[model samples]
Target chain A: MKVLVWAEHEQGALKDATLSAVTAAAGLGAVDVLVAGDSAGSVGAQAAQIAGVEKVLVAGDAAYAHGLPENVAPLVVALMAGYDAFVAPATTTGKNIAPRVAALLDVAQISEILSVEGPKTFTRPIYAGNAIATVESSDAKLVITVRGTAFAKAAREGGSAAVETVAGTGEAGLSSFVGAEIAQSERPELTSAKVIVSGGRALKDSETFAATILPLADKLKAAVGASRAAVDAGYVSNDHQVGQTGKIVAPEVYIAVGISGAIQHLAGMKDSKTIIAINKDEDAPIFQIADIGLVADLYSAVPDLVARV
Target chain B: MKILVPVKRVLDYNVKPRVKADGSGVDLANVKMSINPFDEIAVEEAVRLKEKGIASEVVVVSIGGAKSSETLRSALAMGADRAIHVLSESEVEPLAVAKILKGVAGEEAPDLVILGKQAIDDDSNQVGQMLAALIGRPQGTFASKVEVEGDAVLVTREVDGGLETVKLALPAVVTTDLRLNEPRYASLPNIMKAKSKPLSTKAPADYGVDTAARLTVLKVVEPAVRQAGVKVPDVEALVEKLKELGVA
Candidate 1:
């Protein structure tokens, strides 16, 4: 089976999430990475270095600059010939584009698959990770989006696959890019971060939340996350939310402070290798899954822990 | 300009679902159900637009069993002008659901269509983009902020890194993300009035769409459980444990 993996990138640099997707794609069959963006030749070159990639397809056109679903979905469909499956990282961009491609192809898209049981069968979490469903697609062509945290990142530089330029379908004339406000942060991205320091509503307000969590995060060089309650309480922006409805992260070390460990929050971070929960309430559900539990007031414990660490 | 919002009936968010003993699927026999939280947000957004006079009318639609009308009624109580129920007993996949919604859009001709990014049950965040594709229209998905300006709608989407704003011409599709708006509960008077609201019913065949399952579920199982670990007595012990683990 031949599979086409959409290589997600930003500012012409390949994203690590794409490497995880390439690894997932490799399990299915021969992998071809598609890097589509204006002046993204370097991105294609970077994709070619991923181990096990058979080829790197590049579509450098002005219309593909913003990675809009209108432009990218049709492009993927146009190139779907001779490929049995199309895989993409289940990032925001992939979630936005993959279903359109599936609809255009008249097939059901298997989303956020955790494991590839077979060429046409996979397992994915349903009900926000409360259950896992193993589904087999009957469509002639498979469309899939892989959870980046499930698969290990493919080796970055071992292969020397050749790159080829593909024609792009310019401007679907449907949507226009306005502006973007991307958060600039020195810490690692939450999904890909090795260590995460997450706060909950018990942080009280925005100022206390930041003052208490930021120092710990900075010391560990970890990404910061917030519970839904914390975000709803206006302690942080929605982008920092980690839950079933928010970003799912599986870091090496996860530290939850003042979080009551709601089921929704556990859906996002339970996959972390090691979990540490510090809450004043000993019965807070977060302690149920935490490898290391501390029943103390986070106001003082977090600061003490940060200074000690 | 009219707005069409698609709501879904899903297991209530607060309920923790249980896998069946036979490993067939989730046990929903007696589970309480509610409108998907995100779609409720979509309906709220549409109603707010109508209140702002940006939308002349707000219509809500759902494709499911007869019980879905109750979900539509909830939307109506929240302030939708009318409702449409595409009756189907069996599960409809996202692709087929998009086809049905496309047919509905063809008939309704709404200026904007808003949907939840995904259902809490299936967690398949597909229909909005798929509907946009089937209808050949622009899509602004995972929207946190939506505004109608002249002939176009400016949607601020919650993307991976931060937020992105896009301009889509009229008759576009949008999917709601969190932080869009706090949905208001149905008032007692509004609930009473919603029973009399116009709710039209249609069939999938009426739209010339085939509601067939393309994917077969082999089995459903619970995820691996994480075992609770030992509790550390104090901050010093926690730091010492982290140091032992080589993660500090």
Candidate 2:
């Protein structure tokens, strides 16, 4: 099978998530990488160096500079003729673009695939990760998005494939980009961070969330995360949410503060190497997976832990 | 302008699904069901648009079994003008749902379509985009804020680490995220009134679409379990343990 993998990048450097996607596509068959952006040439050179990539395809166009799905979807559709499968990392850009490509091709798309049983078979979590379903697709052209945490990143060196240029379909002109407000944080991204400290609704409000959770997170240099309840309660922004509906993180250490451990929140972090729970309720479901359960009030425990650390 | 909102009934977000003994699928015999949380937000957004006079009508639609009428009624109670239930017993994937919705959109000629970014049951997050692509309209997914002008709608979407604003032409699709709005509870009087409102049901075949399973589920299994290790009496002990592991 000839599989085309979208090489997701930012600032001309490949994202760590795409390495996992490359690993997923390489499992199926021969792999080709497509770099679509204004600086595709620089990115293409980097993509061509990833091990097991057969060839690199570059579409250097300003319309794709921000990777607006409206522009990227048509480019994928135009290049879908010779490939049997198309894959992307299940990131914001990939999630936005792959579905449109699948729809234009009139095929069903598989999202957040956890395992590749075969070229047509995959394992993915449904019902908020309560049940894992293995499914076999019958579509002629398989469009898939691989969950980054489920697979190991492919090696970044030891291969040099030829890079080829591809033309972008002119802009659809249906939607125009107005502006973006990106959070500038010195800490690592939540998805790739080695340690994460998450807060829950028990924190009460935004002030407490920052006052309690931020100190411990800063002491450990860990990424800050929040349960959906906290995000819904306006304790933090949506980007900080860690749950089935939010970003999934499998860090080395996951600390839950004031969280009751809803199943949806656990689904995103249960795979962490070590888990710790600090909540007022002893029966909070978070204790079920915590390696260290501290039964106490977070208001007191969190500040103490922050000082001790 | 008429606005359409697609809603789906799923196992309530609070309920943790359990796999059956035979590994067939989740046991839903006695599980509590409600409108998907995101879909509720979608319905709420539509109702707000109607209230603001930006939309002349708000129609809610669902595709499912007989129980789906209950879901549609709830939408009507929340302020939808009427309801359309596309009755189907088989498992309707995203593609089939989009096709059926396309048929309904052609008949309704809605200027705007609002839907949940994803259904919690399958979590596919594909229908809205698929419908937009099939109808040759633009989409603004994961919308946190929306503003309508004469010919276009400006949507502020929640992206990875930030927010992005886009202006899509009218006759577009917008998928709601959690921050869009807080859904209103259906008052007793409104629930009573919803039952008398018009509700039209049709089979999937009426839309000239096959709501068949394009994929077969080979197995259903529980995720790997994590065991609770030990408890710490004080914060000092926790710090000591973390230091021992070199994590702190």
Candidate 3:
């Protein structure tokens, strides 16, 4: 079986999500990476270096710069003739376009596949990870989005593959990008960080969340994350949210301060290597998955720990 | 302008689902069910649009079994003018659901359609976009803020990088994110009034759509459990443990 993997990129570099998607697509058979955007040439060159990729297809147009689903969806649909399967990471870009491609092809999409049992069978979590359902698709061609955290990033450098240019569909004129307000952070991206410090509603307010969590994050050189409660409470930006609806992370160390560990939040961070929980409430659900639990007031405990670090 | 909001009834967010002993599916024999949380936000946005005079009427719809009428009533109590319940006995995939909704849209000809980004039960997150494609309309999904302009809706979406703003023509589809608005709880008086509201029921066959499962479930399994680790007495011990693990 031949698989086409959508190589998502940002700032002209192949995003980590693409690497994980390559890891998933490699499971089926030979993988060909498709990079569609203004900077597809550079991104395709980078994608060609991934170990398992056989070739990189570069489709470029000024219209594809913003990764708008309306613009990107058509490009994917146009290129789906030969491949038996199409795969992309379950990121915002992938989730937005994969369904449209599936709809255009008259096939149902299998989303966020956690495990691939065969060419057509997969496992994915449902109900906020409270249950796992294994499903099999009988469609002639499969369209899927793989959860990045479920797969290891494919090797960055190996045998070089040939990069070929593909035709661009140009703008569909259905939608236009109206600028974005991405948070500029000096720390590592939350999803790919080695250590993550997450705060919850217990941080009370934004000022307190920054005052308490930032010190520890700074000391440990960890990316700062927040539970949905913290994001909904306006204690932090939604970009910092780590949960079922937010960015999923499997960092080396995950420290949950004041997070109650609702299943939604746990679904994002439960796969971390070492988990630690600190909250005033001993019965917080976070303790159940925590490799080390500390029952203490975060206000006092975080400060003391920050000073020591 | 009539606004259509599709709500789904799923197991309550607080309830932790249990896999059946036979590994078929989650046990829903006697579980509490409520409108999906994100769908509640969509309903709230539609009602607010009506209150703001941008929408003349709010019509809440659900495509599910008879029990889904209860969810529609809850939406009615939340200030929807009417409800449409498309009854289906078996499972319906997102593509089929989108087709059913397209049929309903053809009949109602609403100016706007609002829906949750994804149903928590399946987390497919495909219906709204697919419906937009089927109906040949633009869509602004995962919307955190929606502004009704003349003949268009300016939506601020909560994207991965940060927030992205987009403009879609009227007769568009908008999916609600969590931060869209805090859904108002239905009051006693409104609940009483909702009992008298018009609720029309139809089957998928009436819409010329088949509510059949496209994907077969091989089996359902309980996720691997994470054993709780040892608890330390205080912050110092926790620090020591982290140091021991070489994470600090």
Worst 10 residues of 2 chain A by lDDT: A180-189
Question: For residue B165, what is the lDDT in candidate 3?
Answer: 92
Interface RMSD of 2: 1.2
- Across all candidates, what is each one's fraction of true contacts kept? 0.92, 0.80, 0.76
Candidate 3 local lDDT, B6-59, one digit each (tens):
999999988878889999999988999999999999999999999999899999
DockQ list for all candidates: 0.90, 0.78, 0.77
Better of 1 and 3 by TM-score: 1
> On residues A145-206, what C-alpha lDDT tens digit does candidate 2 reach at each position?
99999999988897698999998897888888888888778877899888899999999999
True contacts kept of 3: 0.76
Ranked by TM-score, top first: 1, 3, 2
C-alpha lDDT (0 to 100) for residue A2 of candidate 2: 95
Better of 1 and 3 by lDDT: 1
Q: Return the lDDT, model 2, position A114.
A: 95
**What is the C-alpha lDDT profile of model 1 across A1-309, one tens digit per residue?**
999999999987789889899989988999999999997799999999999999999999988888899989999999998688999999999999999999999889999999999989999999999999999999999999999889999998998999999988889988989999988899998998999999998999999999999999998989999999998888988788898888899999999999999999999999999999999999999999999999999988999988998
Q: Say which candidate scores most in TM-score.
A: 1
| Ordering by DockQ | 1, 2, 3
Which clashing pairs does model 2 show? none
lDDT of 3 by residue, A158-227 (tens): 9498999998998777777777899999998898899999999999899999999998999999999999
Residue pairs with colliding backbones in model 3 are none
Q: 1 or 3: which has the higher DockQ?
A: 1
